[model samples]
Target: MPAVTSAPADSQRPDTKPRRRVGRPAAAVLDQDGITAAALQLIQKSGYDGFTMAALARTLNVAPSALYNHVSSKRDVLVLVQDHLTSLVDVSAFESEPWERAVRDWAWSYRDVFSKHTPLIPVIAVLPVTDAPKTLAMYEAVSAGFSRAGFPQERIISAIVAFESFIFGSAYDVTAPADIFDSGSMAATTPHFTSAVARLAEQGFESQADVAFSLGLKALIAGLGGFRA
Candidate 1:
């Protein structure tokens, strides 16, 4: 008869319980959607830097290690938040519309998404796109809309890039805090800015903000068409 061999510490230890499943342990008992939702709430309430994995774990009543079971890092959470925002955009908004309307609607939707998550605006701009399906799907739909709008393939892609750049740039400027314009110095500092503000009255621009968006968007579309023609 062969001698009986002792089990390893994990197996032989009576205090240790049997493993629950074959896969990796979950970070939390709740599902991934729940975690992602919680993360959004946290960011909305406290801003990005204010939130931490430890704090999230405390809120979820799980060990911090468990969070890694669902998210790889804070960067991963940021990506998920961006993905969630993009998913909220209505792709149907682009369907059955003329090229200009479809493209404009898409630009407005992109602007709205960024505006809603102002804190994440920079992050979205910088986040590396690694097979992000929702983001890619939005782009593909916009591209298809442009194609149907009679734009050549190159122009279609160019139109999408130009549209996105305009949207992000415009939203960032509009949403930036007003203190940036509050310096007391006149000709001594930012003379060009002072001159620009002075010209605002002469230009009879009652609402520069609204006018800028409309003018920029129209010009972008016109430029795209001109590029192809």
Candidate 2:
């Protein structure tokens, strides 16, 4: 037989370039943690108006369909974001501390977590907890503490809702300017309000938000504590 010339070594070598996937992955490369992290970072940089499935996919170097494999819609991603953020709140306090102390720790932690992520508050506020296991878990922990303290069954959800409304709105307050209460040119006409603001400044605190938060949180705990049996 005629000698067969050996093919060029380079020609026989396998292509080094990555092969394009022909079908769905054997295991999904995207998971909720990865998607939620990317979505959080993207939202922080772009704001909610600019956040989209396409934008998130681009951030992860994948196609939008890849995200759909993990999350059904933008709302699903928002639920993930809310749940992840809630996981950072100090629910551990509910387990170890007295109810009042636990409430303080949890409230402050929740406010701090979302203060940095106020942009997500609108979506988080509306996202249902039915699908957010982690978020629901936080509620469960808090609710258990409430029940332990003899909080009425019918009032638990309502009470938690009241705390959350205060906490979420406080997150926005954290972003307000130090002089947000200043009447400016109208200060002369609003002497009582201006004087109150001036006296608050005289307290030597570094942050107006901190003062208001402390006052509001104290009031909430007192009001809600009455419901505890």
Candidate 3:
């Protein structure tokens, strides 16, 4: 028999150059634009809690580990999505405008964005809005408007805070669950609840609430004038 001496494992192996893992690696897809777009779509459709690594992986047709190479976690994705959305706010677009008009425009723009991202409202409500770059841009824009009008630093900050708070609070109110307002159970048991319901029925609660919100916001803006004192 020919000396079929067992060849070494290495010798038996085909000597073809080890196939360089050719083609774009998974890391290639994790760039800022791709990830940010995916995150924004997810946010717009399902909100923050609905986003997951698995969903993102499926969206990009990559492994979950691939995302970690770009973003640390879903929270990081959320932050990026927020920053991208915030960047659309162009304060300079309203530049050289009157201070009150600038402030009102800024406030309305902020309100519109937050309302669209209702799920993000709570996240934005608590997170320091100044942390994001676009948010900072908006801050600078508002600050510039206030500064130009001779408003002090503290007042500028306060006005920004109050405007955001009012808008967010109203958005929450409109979106709050009806179960939360179920006075039926209490109305039957509590005299205070009963009286309040009677008054609400007589007063046209919905109209009153709408009027109150409008007046309240106007009052808030007027109160900012006091900031100059």
Candidate 4:
């Protein structure tokens, strides 16, 4: 047999590069935006009860351990979502308008944002702003507005808290059915209440909730005057 030269060693081969590994592409690196977006979708579709580290990881196509690299826990993801929601609130009016007007605008914006994420209200309401830079920044702007509007330093937080409580409740109300207060057979026994309900319809407002929210918000804003320095 003719001498058979062995093929050159693989490492010494000419015009040959290492075999390109053909398999699934690497998973995209997880980042805060991707995490926040996935979390929001999961919450919207499944509610808070369905949100979990494992679920989040699955949604991101990664192991649960991978999530810990970016977020310490589910609560950390919540903080991201909360900060994003807060950023949507229109606080710009504070710069040009009177404090009351600015607050009114901000309240409407705040209520609108939270109404869509009602399930998160309780979580965010109690969440501390310690590590949430955007949340802290929102408070700083509102605080400065309140300060300029003559709110006492000691009472600024209280005023903000009170306003937030009303905003949150109003947000929930936005999701209520039009006949949520319908007393049915009991309407006959509660004459005053039944009459009020009818009168609300007679008023020709586009939305009962909108009308109620507007009336209550105006009253609340006016009442906040008591907190001003």
Candidate that beats the other on lDDT, 1 or 2, i.e. the better one: 2
Local distance difference test values of all predictions, in order: 0.73, 0.90, 0.70, 0.90
Between candidates 1 and 4, which one is better according to lDDT? Answer: 4
For candidate 3, the C-alpha RMSD (Å) to the true structure equals 7.5
lDDT of 2 by residue, 16-126 (tens): 899888997665478878999999999999999999899999998888887888888898889888889999998898888888899989999999999999999998887
Q: How far is 59's C-alpha from truth in model 4 (Å)?
A: 1.3
- Top candidate when judged by TM-score against the true structure: 4
**Which regions of candidate 4 are displaced past 4 Å?**
1-26
Could you list the CA RMSD of all candidates, in the order they appear?
10.0, 4.6, 7.5, 2.9
lDDT of 2: 0.90
TM-score against native, each model? 0.70, 0.86, 0.67, 0.89
Let me know the TM-score candidate 4 reaches against the reference structure: 0.89
Where in model 2 is the C-alpha error above 4 Å? 1-29
For residue 123, model 1's alpha carbon misses the true position, in angstroms, by: 1.8
**Model 4: which ten-residue window has the lowest total lDDT?**
15-24
